[model samples]
Target: MPEKVKTDLGFADLQCRKSDVGRISRIAKAAYSFNRRFFGKEIKKPFHIIICYSRKEFDDIWGAETDAWLTGFATKTGTIVSFRDDLIRKYNPRKEATLAGTLRHEINHIFYFQIYGSYEPAWLLEGLTLQPPFEPFTLMENDKKRLKGPLPHLIYSTNGKTFFKQAPFLYSMAFLATRH
Candidate 1:
């Protein structure tokens, strides 16, 4: 059970430590703005943002084993939970991961869910989540022979247990597929 924290923002209800509340609120606000700009529309729904400070906290909230590579998640349009970037950086030391990007990616999920009611073809969902400054596109990264191999089917079709087997390639390929 997590304690709820009050936030004076209209876009989201934030729950985190006193030290992180402001930063998370700011990032969330900025991410929502980016989403609004990307979608070229305005959304007024209030969402929840939970900042988890440890792997145990995140796993407890998730009620299962989450991928070690992921830093955050948008459980649905109404809520998102993220691990502290600094605490999780060890998992993505070379991946250029950041707290801002995680929030942006997760919030995009909420924005799209509001629009399409449900985002399908996990590739599109995953792809759309990787907007500029959030998860930049790269042709390929080193040690990614999985990309050279036959690309996995759409991201959703792949079982969640193995969804991140080749995440780097999946994200890159998804970005390419969704890029206009």
Candidate 2:
């Protein structure tokens, strides 16, 4: 249903249904703008997106490779898969918001690599990056939705050991720590 667009870059490619172009473009632009605002300048990077009709289609697109190597990767070395998408027909009608979150999250990884030479600790990267005060989510309808909350069980460390055990809870706690 969607047409394929190949850029001169030869690396990035996208396929989308005829109706989704405007929506997808707007999502990408907003993500780009958000990144530009917090980080001092805009970055022009090659991003390839496939508009999937279903979650199966998304999975297929995700598994496709550049040559033979997998085109995807997880943010963590031990975590084999980098990104995952769930197509919620009803709950996920907000594609633009979804796209915005995905782009911002992944792009933050690249930004950190540029600065620190590699992804820092999960707590540091995810902790600070999750800072909504820095770049808030696009789904907010009012001040309440835009509101920031506390992270409940966060534990910080100069060394990585303590933080990785209960990363999720720790990150949540860390986020709360920043608020208070």
Candidate 3:
């Protein structure tokens, strides 16, 4: 197994396994490429991303940060991403969700950091970042069951912070909002 160390927000570690390293590298590159196209110009700085395989390593690297439920985090210094070996072993034995979801999700956060230096409103930032023209956003097609088609108008009338509490509700709204 690859080593992981605790960091301020989660785990901090390097990806050493050939396959894991390759996957992270590929996704990070895709994130950068997507950001460049979204902005219509190349972002000059290179991103530094750190990965960890276990909660202990994540806690060790995360140090004393208080927020819980943080599966991963992105900062200017680097991005810390976490995944449980148990989850992989029990559920995603094939590694599909690891690459398709966590990898892309955190990397998109990194790209958002580069695009907007300060923490923007969670709604605008998360909404725009999670929406289309982004590569990972396109992967939503693969999870059809998760999509509840054509959200009700009442959902969009509410604030993002409120609706997002119910992720399925928020996703339906997102789909509705993005459409013409």
Give the Cα lDDT of each candidate: 0.74, 0.45, 0.49
Candidate 1 C-alpha lDDT tens digits along 8-38: 5687888887777878788878988988888
List the RMSD of every prediction in angstroms. Answer: 2.8, 8.7, 7.1
Relative to the unseen true structure, what is the C-alpha lDDT of residue 97 in candidate 2, on a scale of 0 to 100? 30
Off by over 4 Å in 1: 1-4, 139-143, 158-169
- Ten residues in sequence with the least summed lDDT for candidate 3: 4-13
TM-score of each: 0.83, 0.51, 0.54
User: lDDT: which is higher, 1 or 2?
Assistant: 1
lDDT of 2: 0.45
Error of 3 at 111 (Å): 2.9
Q: What tens-digit string does per-residue lDDT give for candidate 3 at 1-180?
A: 745332221222344344566555555566556655666665445554565565566667667442343455565575545553344334342344444355455655665666677444443444555565542343244335455564344243233346335544444345435543
* Candidate 1 residue-wise lDDT at 60: 91
Residue 27 in candidate 2, Cα distance off native in Å? 1.3
> Could you give candidate 2's per-residue lDDT for residues 1-180 as a string of tens digits?
446443222222344555655665565456556655767764444445454554445456444422221222223221112222334222333333344566555555555555465555555665555578544533223322323444243344424345334543543544544445
